[model samples]
Target chain A: MTWVTFLGNATDPKIGGIAFFGIFLSLVVFLIGQWLFKISNGFFLFQPLFVGMVLGIFILWLLSKWFGVALPTFYTAAYKPGGDILFWFLNPATIAFAVPLYRRNDVFKKFWLEIILSLVVGMVISLFAIYYISKGLGLNNDVISSMLPQAATTAIAMPISGAIGGTPAVTAMACILNAVLIYALADILIKVFRLNSDPVGAGLGLGTAGHTVGSAKAVQLGSVQGAMASIAVVVISIVVDVVVPPFAHMMGLF
Target chain B: MASNATQAKNQAPEHEPAPILQQMAIFASVLFVSSLISPLFPKSFPVPTPVIGLVLMYLLLATHIIKLYQIEKMADFLISLIAFLFVPSGVQMAASLNVFTEHGPMDGVMMIVTIILATIILLVVIAYTTACFMWVSRKLFHKSTDVE
Candidate 1:
């Protein structure tokens, strides 16, 4: 038993072959996504991350079938190595959010109580609404769990989702979905709600529901709304971090 | 108020972004130190290491122990790549493709409906609630001089 077997069966050349190929495959697919996103002029539908994931999975499936291997076996062998490494960076990325929160500390200082109070109320109400709606619709517990933390940006939301026994992948999709919905609806929502007079409230709402994408839309509305949205993204993430785990525990979701 | 914010931003001391290698080193050290500190907390209420790192980073910035210039570029870089970083986990969804089809298309449709409906309700509720609170706060805290 050589040291190589400790990692996996060393005698099998395919193991080493796939490892290098896996990293290359992930990078190439991601680069392709970036390219497509660029050419598409940053269209929401061509978002690089979303496009990369779908394309990567599709290509991996094709490779698995071509190689006469099981999908799980191929994935663990070929994609998981690079994929896992990429996923590990999510931790540091989560910490990077502190920068924006710090930069916009002024807005927070002025309306700290109002911002915190409103977000908490919104979060609590949203949680109850999501849980009961999912339950009433007879969605599975895993699906419900994923949907619970969709309000926060993906960096923060994914960890909380996993902690509370949700599927992080599903949570990721939900976060993106939430943002896209907000992007599409912001115009009509503003007009119907007559939010023209209150940019701060509008911004907070955008960031709370949409995360980054919503913030982008908020930016288009006005500078004040943009700043508010940015502030809301960080603050809501913090609120979700402190509040969701306990809430989930009490609800017996974990 | 918007002009006030721009004025505040202008008042901030201008600093060039840190050199790239130094930026990476600073980030790496923070991540390392944070991983070490996160375990000190009791297991009963688990806070993820990254969350702890966020607070630590905030304190460092607030105290000026670590200048914003040093990490701002790197931090922005990381935030931009969040989608790319999650590709691995998102791809894992491939493993569970059966989820959508296990109960047949009807169940899958129901699941989609549930997610969409819940998201819409949350969006509307949060927006109106936040706006309402802001309005009330302003009214309470800043009364008209006419009252006098």
Candidate 2:
């Protein structure tokens, strides 16, 4: 068999397409997303990450449907391995977040009390809001758990979901959706609520509600706002990590 | 802080870039340590190891064990590419298409609407609440101290 066939064929477990295809496809999709974002003038809704995800999903769906590829077989053979490696990198990347936090340690100290109070209140409200809303919508526990940590970054949210018995994919989906929604609507919300004057407050809210994407928006606002947002991302993650599981347990969510 | 900032700026031209190999090694060592200690905790522990890794890095920096100059470039590069790392998992969402289809289109729409609404509410509430707290605190502190 030729080298191309060895890499493309789904049935061949050892030398199959799973090893390389996912990385290649991811890069291609990323480029497409970047192009879309560039042409769209860096519109938040046109974020390359979200674009790439949707495109990747659609392409996979098309492959499965039009080309008669067996999804289950392909998933186990190709997607899982490739995706797993990339997912593993999220850990180190998350660790890299410390660089920013370290850089802005003074800001953290200056507003530490305000940051803590805001995050605590925001997190409580977020948890309760997601709980009741998803429950009222008749969603199951897994879905509820997945959505609970939606306000956090994916690296933080995914494990929280696992600890709480939710699927990581659903949690990831919710987190991304949360970020996109906040990114798209943050300005309007700020204007409507008259939050334009308080950059630190705005940054904390953005980070607490929107995580990394929100921080990106905060960065656009100004350096102090960006720093505050970055700090919020870490603070909120740590707060939620320490508090959510117990809260979920008390609520009998698990 | 001003002096430190200026010093950093002045040192910029003289500072040589840390070799890529050394930077990678530092990153890998931190990651390795994080992974090593993460599994020691029970499954129910809320704080995951990556977070622990982050805290460790922060502590190292605070204590001057790891200088900012050593890892700044590598860390920035990794963070810039962070979204790229997440794409694979995002792609894996394709596998869960059955979840939406199985629940039917109406339910899916409801789910989407519910999530969007919740997110907006959360953002508004969090931002406003934080602003309010800051305002209140400033008032309280100012009144007690008799300062502007």
TM-score of each: 0.74, 0.83
lDDT of 1 by residue, A1-254 (tens): 33222223323665553345545666777788889879987665566656777788898789778776676666776667667767787777666766666666556557767777888888888898888888888877777887788887676678788889988777876776575456556677678877656666777887788775566566667656765676677677778887788888888897
Interface RMSD of each: 4.9, 3.5
Q: What lDDT would candidate 1 get against the real structure?
A: 0.70
Note the Cα lDDT for every prediction shown.
0.70, 0.71
Candidate 1 is graded, for docking, as acceptable
Ten residues in sequence with the least summed lDDT for candidate 1 chain A: A1-10
Instruction: Give the TM-score of chain A, superposed on the true chain A, for all candidates in the order listed.
Output: 0.64, 0.76
TM-score of chain A of 1: 0.64
Candidate 1's DockQ: 0.42
Whose DockQ is greatest here?
A: 2
Candidate 2 residue A148 Cα shift, in angstroms, is 2.0
lDDT of 2 by residue, B27-46 (tens): 78887897788778765544
What total of clashing residue pairs does each candidate reach? 0, 1
Flag regions of model 1 displaced more than 4 Å. A1-23, A34-43, A140-146, A149-254, B1-14, B102-105, B119-124, B143-148
